[model samples]
Target chain A: MEIIKTSNLKKSYMLGNVEVKALNGVDTSIEQGEFVAIMGPSGCGKSTFLNLTGMLDTPTSGEIYLEGKDVTNMNSNMRAEYRLKYMGFVFQFFNLFNELTVMENVMFPMMLNKRSNYKERAKELLNLVGLGDRLNHLPSELSGGQQQRVTIARSLANDPKILLADEPTGNLDTASSIEIIELFRKLNQEQGQTIVMVTHSPEIGGMTDRIIHFRDGTIEH
Target chain B: MSSVFFYARKDAKKNWKMFVFVIMAIAISTANIIIINGFMDGLTDGFLEKTMDTSSGHINIYPNEQDKYIEGLGIKEKKLDGLDGVVAYSPRITAGGTLHYKEKFKTIKILALDPSKENEVTILLSKIDSGKTLAANDRDGILISYRLADDLKVKIGDEATIVFENGKIRVFKIRGILHTGLAMDTNTIIINFEDASEQLNLFNKASIILVKLQDGTLSGQYKNKISGELGIQKIKEWEQEIESVLSSFKTFRDISNFMNAIGLFTGAVSVGIVLYINILHRRRQIGILKAIGMKDSQVLFVYILQAVFLGIIGILIGDALGYAGTKYLEAHPFPDPTLGSLGPRFHLSLIYDASLVTMLIIILAAAIPALMASRTNIIKAIWGE
Candidate 1:
């Protein structure tokens, strides 16, 4: 049931003739329907690994298999198609489009994927996130936690098999953080969603079914 | 396509300030181009009409002149007797003369024409303002311009003495006043060729032959046939007679075109800056779009769609404003002393070709910025340093 797997992944960056290895020789796998948390200190390649796994960036040298289909060398347009059809992401900063209303923000991913029933699906997702009454409110009017909930709703719009969360609670208060975690738990336990989240908080990391801790560029456990 | 349209509408609504600014810039530039072109068209048409009315017939026939003094009196006359498309043929004697009325005298050019056939050569005589047209039996009657009558203190039926080159004197009565809306009217006089022949002492001679062809006939073929029959080396057409005037019009058109190009360039710059700022401000939105699996082309389409929206607004406004301005100018005309005694009136009619060219220029101005906006890179546009 290995839904996502990477073998000997390596990533590097060039800064003024000096090379920086962000992720070096990492191998990992996550089973289907598992809520997994990746834990690491700052600059420990957690975001890099998430980006690679989410298909936002390609590893320098590695093999990435999603549902047993190798996606390591996909072109830009092909990768975009794959991302639209099979994956969704929640960012650390709650990167909601300010110009769009809360409902419109949630509807963005579906619109991008050209879903025919985008409006109805968006309303349903907003209701599920408990923000149906605030559909017309813009992102700027929403609090950090509300915005994160809207982002979560948007991630589900395409019915993606794999949902990637990069510090989803990074910018929320304690109460908002707990509410968001409970929502994730509901989505994972009830709806059997497969989620891979990156977090610095041990408390949030502990709530996941499995935790992968990392230091520098290597997994510690 | 529907999704892109929806997003574009939202984006334009969100950035209404930039949108309005771009539209206004386009509109103003387009309006300027239209108004200038219209004005030029009006002026050129007015000049051409006056020239045709006062001087040259639609077609003129003259002897080929290899030398400067291909004497006007030496013109040969042939019987165009049974030509199917020939309308009217009038022979004329042209010479510069001086008229003396009271104590004042002024030099003028006289066209000694057959009184019965003169209307075929110059149509403006039919629009005479005072007295009667010259009759075939009237040997000593002359038709003088209204402005010349005013300058000479002469009225209809008053006698004016004209002095020909050989010191021959002929005292002629002013039979009528010709008022053409043109400058040449003030310096022209019409007299019967018999009296002109008696005064100048040139018998059975004419300076030029004018032929008014039937409407819709091929003037070129007729002109060539006439040239071949007459064995003349040079045959001048209506267009050739006004070569200098047409050249001036072409020069003005080129200047207007250059001005329109500059205006469009500036408009494009304004739109470009507006779009650049818009893209910079919406960088995060673009990033979010890309993260949501939107391709670069899709993101670029949104910006291009926005630019097109702005261009359409601009062109519409510009065309309206230009049309209104031109109409206003047409309705209110300034006095032109060159239009003789008929008084000045608004010149409105423009050449259709010029108007079409101006419209094309305006459209091109609006489209360049939109196309440029469509080529912007989504990732770089979004991820600014």
Candidate 2:
């Protein structure tokens, strides 16, 4: 079943009197539980597409349907609510709070929702990411791959239906990149976690269920 | 809200150096306010006590006719002798006189009291700094204030000649020195009642009556009680007679309030700069928080709570320091060259006022930066623009 759809999505901004079209007239859809990759060169608007789909930025003109519900015109607060309820995100920098311990960082999103059993759930998620023993350590004490794993654990804290990642392997070495990809593949195959990843590497794109390539702010084929 | 506090605590701990800097700034400002106000209150209290002891007493009875003596003092004394709140009373003859010590001449108020009965209503005898008090039989012994001695370069046992308004001159030995801390002491002299009556040509007549009341008795209440029997216009409470001193003290307090306002402004500006810098440093983190479904209000609340927490901790520490400093001053007062020891006094109302003012300044400091953070462009922040 189609879990996400966007019709004629466009995003534009003015940079000191020049209108820059970041995304223009894009149509796309993704099935539920599919591990999809979005690929393009620099300045081709792949990141813009991910931001719109993740509900982090507004589109200039479009309709976005998540599980058959049109959510294109939702206000910022409603978009935040939707993101909390159904979407999760991972970034290249692994933005874990440096001051908090590993467990506390994982527990942050759940803390916002005021969920019960957060301590136990956070520990459980840390263990699931194979970082249970490092729960008391700060993010500064972890390696790059370990920090990314912790970021993944944090993203899953609210039990979101879809996980969006932008350049997840961009900042990692080859070994860490492979480990992260394997982890994503395992989550998709075993738990049926829907994921849409933006990447520059063809090898990473080839591992996904399908690839959506883009150029000049629209789907290229 | 819980998440706001939780994140606020995290951020505070992470950036503790900056938090400590802001806290110390606020704490020092608050401490200055407390100390300055407390010291001023102590000075005012000391001045009032000295005025009551040396001149005004709790109540002063003046003559209805300024040029005449208080009529029927014997009858009034007999009526007031057994009054419940009237601890002691003394009749005094006050006359303006010119004093000559060597070549220096100054105008002075001559207060003549029966030394045997005057100690009951005034603290002059106990406050004698150099010589003994006048005895009942001592013919022409006089007590001059310390400030008067300093001005005339006279010492105890020196002979100072006084010329009364009636042009009668008498040379009297300075038997003692008085220091009462009130400004009136600087230009006043005390002489024996017999000598005053002989020199001023008064026959058994007194100019004013000083009355001491019992502890916890309000002088206004006693003044009201006696105003009807005596002439209403002639009865005056100590407060009524010390208007100039009271006004000067009020002016001092107003100046202190102005200094406190400056302290508060300085504290607020320092705190605001620190908070703004901290928000600037955490712009990306704030963006990430917004991206992950945190509302703008929630994000703003986190920074505000952080600032409030720092302010509260600072105020608690400052109050503790202020209390200890004032108590220490009370125990070991600062010794003045002329006025003996001076100490600081603590007023609880001042603490409440200072705390309220500090809290307001802190909130203003925190809110300006928090508003800026809330209105930050999320995309620009996330992309490090």
Candidate 3:
């Protein structure tokens, strides 16, 4: 069954007198537990599409269905509730709260969710991400690859159904990038964690189950 | 709510300097309002006590309807003296006169009364700096204030000649020196009533009657009662008689109120600016929190909790400092040359009310920033706008 489906999705925004079409007439579906890569050059709407799927942005037209439920017109608060329950995001910058320790950063979403077992779950996720020894370390004290690992751990805190990564390893070195890719591959293979990643790297795209290429605002199949 | 509290505590702990600065600013403002008000209260209370104890009794009776004397001055005085709650009553002949010592002449307010009888209602004998108060039989003996003595360069045993309104010159020996602790008494001289009546040639005439009440008697109630019974329209309570001093007291209160308003406004603005800056700086963090599925209300709760926590601590510290400062001043009062030996007093109720007001002001100051933070566009804030 398709976990997320979008039909003829379009998004337009204004920049001065120019209207930029970030996405146009995009029809797509991702089945459950699939590791997919959205590959495109800059300004091709890859991140915008990922954001719309993550409910971080709304499409100008068309419908978004999660498990056959249309959520295209959901308000910001309802979208947030859906994201909390079913979506996790990893940004290029890691986006870990600099002031919170690794353990606290991982537990933040769960705390907001008011999960009773958040602490134990955060600890387990940190250990799984190989950051168990650095639970108390702040993000600033961590290496680039370690910070990405902490971010991944944080993303998995709420046991989200889909992990939406926007250039998760874009800021890391080659070796760190490889390590992060391998971690994502392992999570997909072992836990069947459905993943959608936006990346310019052919190597990262090649590792995914399938790649959807984009040019201008439409998928190139 | 619990998560909000946790976040607020962590934030405050991490940024303790900001919290401490806000708290201290509020505390200082509260202390300023309390201390300034206390000083004004002390000055007013001291002036009232000195004025009342020296000349104006709690209630005074003058000639009714502009009459020079009550229809029966002796009879009215006796009736008031025998009334319930009447502590002491003295009938006095007050005349504007000129006192001459050697070649120097000075205008003076001269009061003629039996010093023994007047001392019962006023602080006469206790105010004497030297010599003795007038006895009933001491016809020519007079008591002069210390300021008058200094101005005239006269002392006890020096005789000063006073020319009354009737141009009758009478020489009376200065039997005692008075210090009334008030500036008005600087030119006051007291003489025996029999001598004054004889010299002024106004026999059986007294212009004013001063009445003291028993302790805890409300002066307003008795003033009205006595005025009605005596059919007099010129009676006044001590507060009414000392209108100028009371006006000065009101001026002091007005100034303190202005200062309090300024202090409170400063506290509000300080907290408001600090919170606004904090939200501006933390916009990215707020956006990220929102993107991570934290509700706007939750984020607002964290910020509001942080502010209220700091505000409450500030108010507590302010109240403590205000109370301590007031107590210290009460014990070791700041001396003023104008009101000698009077100390400033601050009521506990004043501190409590001021603290509550400060808390409310700070919370309101913090809310504007919290609302701004909550309403921020998550996408723009995250993108560093």
Candidate 4:
């Protein structure tokens, strides 16, 4: 089943007087339970495409369908609701709220959705991420890889349909990167979670079910 | 909703030290508004009370509009004695006279009242700076104002001669020095009502009757009663007679208001700048929250709730501080040369007004930054773009 689809997506911005096209005329789809990697060199539209698919940024001109429902023209409020309900995001920097404890950070998405049993759910997610002992520690008190694990635990808080990651392990060392990818592979193979990850590393891309390589502003043929 | 409150509470708790500066700023300004207003009220009320105590006693009954003196005083006095709410009343025979000492003399307004009755009507005898009030049998004894005595260079024992307006001359010993804080203190003389009546050949006549009411607030009611009973058309309440004096107090209030307004403005600006900087520092965090599904209104609400929390806590502390300061002033009044010992009175209405206004100002101050924070573009704020 097609969990995500986009057609002729375009995005542009202006720096000084010149226009910079970030994404140009991309057509793509991801099946449910598919572990896909968007691979590219620096400055490619892979990250932009993921952002567009996640509803973080609107395309200059495009249509996006999530689980066969058109979401391209949704307003910010509706997009926020969709983001909370249908998607989770992991960024390069493991953007955990520094002020929140590890447990509170995981509980944030559940709280946003007003889900019941959020505290227990957060503890369960934290233990699954293997950071059960670090629940009360602040993000700054944790290590780089541990913070990324917290972010991953938080992303799973609402049990999103699609986990969108933009270089989820880009800041980690090789050993931590391998551990993070192993966790992603476990979530994908065991739970049949759909994931669309953006990264530049070919090794990580090769580990996924399929890789969509990109160059300038669109996918390479 | 709960998200807004949770975030607001957590943010304040996590960075309470940063918010302390903002709260203290609000508190100090609130305290100043209360203290300044209290001081101004005290000064104005004290001066006005002194003026009223030395002159009018809540209500004053002047002579009939057509007569120089309210003739037939015996009947008027009897009616005044039976009037309800009348604590005391004094009849004064006002006469223009010229005082003469050895070397100098000045024209003065003479208020001749029975000293015993005058004491009850006003704080007259108690204001004597030195010497003693006249005994009922102490003939030829009169009290002179301290300013008048200074001008004439006369002591309490010295004798002063006065030429009555009716061409009668009498020499009286200065029995007491009056220190009443009014213009009357400069050139007024207090003589026995009998002596002035005899000298002017106006027996059973008085220019005005001053009536002291049990409650000062009942002046208008008592004035109407006195007018209706006595058929005196020239009666006035102290408020009606002191328009000019009250204008001076209005000026004091206006100045106090202007000063405190500036103080509040500064406080508001401080709150604004601090919140703005705080928003800027947390821009990335705000963006992350938005990216994670926090709506724009929730973001706005979080900051606004923070402001409300700050306002409530700050205003509470400020009210306590201002209340303490006012009570301290009341307990230990500071002295003023013109108004005697001055103390600020604590009125709940004043504190309520100050707290409510301060809360409004602080909330508005925080809104600008909160709006900016809420509407920030997610990608740009997160990326520092």
Candidate 5:
């Protein structure tokens, strides 16, 4: 089943008096439980497409349907609600709160939802990411790959349906990048966790079930 | 709401340096207000007490409008003995005189009182700083104000000749020197009533009468009563007699009160700057919160609660420091020439007023910046675009 769909999506921005068209008339869909990679060179609108689908930014025009529900016109608060319950996000910087311990950071999103068994769930997610021993440490104490794993654990705290990642391993060393990709591959294959990722490396794209290549603002065949 | 408090506590606990800076600012501001206000109150109160002790007798009676002296004082004294709430009463003749000592001439107010009756009515008789009180039989002795003696370079054992209003000159021994810290201290003299009657030849007469009441607050009531009963037209309460002087004290007191406003402003600014810098440092954290489905109002409430916590803690510490400062002054009073020693006084209402206003101002101060933080662009902040 198609879990995410966008039709003729377009986004624009004005720098000075000139309008920059980041995305123009793009149509795409990702199936449920599919590990899809969006690959392109810089400034090809790959990040913009991810942002539009992840509810990080609203499109200037066109419709986005998540599980057959049109979400293109959702207000900011409704968008946040959808993000919290149905979608999760991972960024290149692994934006874990530096002040919180690894366990606390994982428990944070669950805390916002006022979940009763959040503590136990957070610990389970951390153990799944293989960072149970590092729960009490801060993010700064961890290596790049370890911190990314914690971010992954935190993203799963609310049991989101689709995980959206932007350059997940872009900041990691070669060994760390491979380990992170393997973690995603494991989550997708074993747990059937649907994910949409934007990456610059062809090697990371090769591991995914399918790769959607883009040039300028449109998908390239 | 629970999450708001949860995050607020995190700020106080994790970012303690900012909290400390804001709290100290509030403490110092509160301390300054308390000290200045307490000092002003003390000066006013001290001067009031001195006036009642050395000058006004809580109620003063003058002659009828048509007469120079109240006729039949013997009858009035008998009626006063039966009056309710009358502690004591003394009839005095305030006369003008000129003094001669070592060829330096100065005009002075000669206040004549019955030695035994005066002793019952006022403390000036016993407040002799350097010598003894007037004796019942010592007819040729006088009491000079200590400040007057200072001006004239005279001592208790010396003699000064006074020319009375009737032009009768007499050389009297200075039996005592009085320091009551009033205008009387520098320009007045006290003489026996009988001597003044003999010198002035005003037999059975007085210029005014000073009446001591059980409570000074009832002076106006008794003044009306005295006016009706004794038919004295010009009777005045102690409050009326000291109106001009007390206004001066209040003017000074009012000026000092301006500091309370400045103190509160300083508190507002301190908390404002702290929250401003704090919001700047935590922009990404705030953006992350917003991006993760936290409502804008929830985000604003989180910072507001942090500011309120700071206000409450700062108010507590400030009250303690201010109270301690005032109490220390009470223990060691500042000396003055007019009112002897003055001590600062603390009012519990000051804490209530300061806390209410300080809390309100700090909340407002914090809201401006916290609102800015809550409204930050999530994508820009998180991605640093």
Candidate 6:
């Protein structure tokens, strides 16, 4: 079943007098349990597409359907609610709250949603990401790989249907990148988790169930 | 809800410098307000007490045709009947007089008081340092204030010649010395009304009638009744009688009050600016919150709660410091040149009522910035260049 879909999506930005079309006429869809990788060079609208699909950006002109519900023109508050319940994002920079402990960071989404059993669920997610021992430590005290693992734990806190990762291993070393890619494969294969990841590494891109290439906004499947 | 509070607490902890600045601003402003109000309250209370104790008997009576000082203005003794709230009435005759005590001469105000009635009007005579109260027939006996006695170099039982209106003179023995701790005391001498009536040749008439009202009764009604009975067109209330003194006190009080208000306003502004900057700096965090599905109202509430917390701390600090400062002032009073005339010391009561008002102001001031910070655009905050 298709869990994420976008139709004729276009995004433009005005840099002084010049209009830069970040995403132009892009149509794509990913299935419920698919581990998909979207590969592109720098400034090739890959991040823009991921942001739009993750509900972080509203396309200038397009339609987005999360689990068959059109969410193109939802208000900011409604969009936030939709994102909380159905979507999770992992930024290239990990983006863990620096002030919060690893356990607290993982529990952030559930806390915002007023979820019961936040502690148990956060503990479960931290253990799943192999950071159970580091739960009490702040993000600043953790290694880059450890922080990325915590970010992944936080993304799973809300039990989101589709995890959208924009360059999840972009800031990590070879071993951390392979470990993160293996985690994504495990989440998809063993747990039936659906993921849409954007990455530049061809080696990482080949490990996904399907690869979607982009040169200038539109996908080359 | 709890999440917002948790985050707000985290944020405040992370930014202790800003928090300290806000607290300090609020404390200083609150202290300024409290001290100024304390002084005003003390001065007004002191002035009013002294004036009531020394001169005006809380109420006064005079003829309807006589408004200002007149030669022969007195309420008839029979007119004292049918007055509901009258505690006592003292017939008084006031006239300028020149005194001679062994050639150390000085012009002074002479109050010809009915000795028995005068005791009911002023508490000063009862507090005499030496000698006894003059009898009704003691035409040769007089009471003088301690400061006046010192200036004239007169001792108890010493005779001083007093020259009244129309160059009429009478020699009276100073039987007592009164220290009322009021300006009027030093320049005033008290004599029996009988002697004054005989000397001034106004057998039954007096210059003024002092009426003491029953405690807790409204003097306004008594004043009207006295005016009606005496057919006096203008009877001055105690507040009006000391208008000059009251106005001066009021002016000083208002200036201090204005300064205190400004301090409070500035304290609020400081808190606001600090919180505003804090919000600006933490825009990314707010965006993260919004992205995590926190409602706009929720975000706004968190910041407001933080501001309220800061305001409370400020007000508490201010109240403590203000109270301590006022207490110190009370213990160590200012060297007042008017002390001899007014009193030895002036003290202020640190009122909780004013502090409550100041707390409300500081809280409101802090809350405004917090609310504004919360209501900012989350998307712009998150994704802006």
Q: Tell me, by lDDT, which candidate is best.
A: 4
Predicted candidate 2 versus true structure: per-residue lDDT over B74-185, tens digit per residue: 7788767857888888889989988899999889889898877688887776777788778777888888888888899998889999989888898999898877776657
Task: At residue A132, give the lDDT of candidate 3.
Answer: 91
lDDT of 1 by residue, B1-385 (tens): 6667778789899889867877887777777777777766667777777777656765676655653222343334444545667777777777888898989887877878886676765675675888988888888788888788888888899899898767888899999997776665777888888888778877766677677778624777877876776666666677777776778779877987788778776777777777777766767667667667877667667767776777777777877777777777667765665543221222333223323443454445435443444444433444343
Q: Give the whole-model CA lDDT for all candidates, comma-separated.
A: 0.77, 0.85, 0.85, 0.88, 0.86, 0.79
The residue pairs that clash in candidate 4, if any, are: none
**Which lDDT tens digits does candidate 3 get at residues B1-385?**
6666767777777778876788898888888777777777777878877788777888888886757765677767777867899888888888889999998879998888877778888875577778887787898788887788888999899988999978999898999987767775679888888888888876777888888899524888998888877778888888787888888778779988999989988988888888788888888888878888877788788888887888788888888888888879889986665566766787887687787888888788888898898887876787674
> How large is the interface RMSD of each prediction?
2.1, 1.1, 1.4, 0.9, 1.5, 1.9
By descending DockQ, how would the candidates be arranged? 4, 2, 3, 6, 1, 5
**Candidate 1 vs 3: which has more lDDT:** 3
After superposition of all CA atoms, the RMSD between model 5 and the true structure is 3.8
Clashes of each: 1, 0, 0, 0, 0, 5
Question: In candidate 6, what are the lDDT values of residues B1-385, reduced to their tens digit?
Answer: 8888887787777887779988888888777777777777766767777777768876666544633343344335666745766778787888888888997987888888877777777665675667786676787898887778889989998999998966998798998887665676677888888888788787667777787777624777767777777766656666667776687677777787788778878887887788888888877777667666677777777777777677777778987888888778767767664443221222333436545666677567667666666566544665554
Question: lDDT tens string, model 4, B120-176?
Answer: 987776788899887666769988988899999999889999999988999999999
Off by over 4 Å in 6: A215-221, B65-85, B94-111, B124-192, B195-203, B218-246, B339-372, B375-384
Off by over 4 Å in 3: A1-18, A24-27, A57-82, A186-194, B62-69, B112-114, B128-137, B193-208, B215-217, B220-224, B233-246, B261-269
Quote the positional error of residue B85 for candidate 1 in Å. Answer: 3.6
lDDT of 4 at A7: 88
> C-alpha displacement of B147 in model 3, angstroms?
4.1
Instruction: Give the DockQ (2 decimals) of all models.
Output: 0.48, 0.59, 0.52, 0.67, 0.46, 0.49
**Per-residue lDDT of A186 in model 4:** 90
Better of 4 and 6 by lDDT: 4
TM-score of 2: 0.88
Judging by DockQ against the true structure, name the best candidate.
4
The digit string of per-residue lDDT tens for model 4 on A139-218 reads 99988899999999999999999999999889999988888898899999998999999988889988899998877888
lDDT of 3 at B212: 87
Summing lDDT over every window of 10 consecutive residues in candidate 4 chain B, give the lowest-scoring window.
Answer: B334-343
